[model samples]
Target: MSLASHLDELSRKHSDIERQINAAMLHPSIDALEIANLKRRKLALKDEIEKLKSQPTSH
Candidate 1:
């Protein structure tokens, strides 16, 4: 996939995870570990997106 599309997909996933985290927070029954995992995944995606964005595009 092209970098732009890949970034878009990652961003979409990050947003979804954010929503999941917020929804999970609303429920007291949600496991803390699960939330932590979700947060970690979100951070990973964000880091990847940033790393990709920082690279110089090749012609």
Candidate 2:
């Protein structure tokens, strides 16, 4: 897949993760460890997206 498409997919995933985190937070029986893991994964994805965006494109 092209870089643009890949970026789009990653962006969608990031948004999904954000929604998941929010939903998890609103739950009455929220698991701390689970939320931490989700947050870690989200941060990793964000870092990856930023790194990809910073790289120079070959066109």
In Å, residue 14's CA in model 1 sits off its true spot by 0.2
Top candidate (TM-score): 1
TM-score: model 2 vs. ground truth: 0.93
User: Candidate 1 on 1-59: residue-level lDDT in tens?
Assistant: 99999999999999999999999999999999999999999999999999999999999
- Candidate RMSDs in order: 0.4, 0.8
Q: What is candidate 2's lDDT per residue for 1-59, written digit by digit as tens?
A: 98889999988999999999999999969998999999998999899999999999886
> What number of clashing residue pairs does each candidate have, in the order they appear?
0, 0
- Pairs that collide in candidate 2 are none
Candidate 1, lDDT over the whole model = 0.99
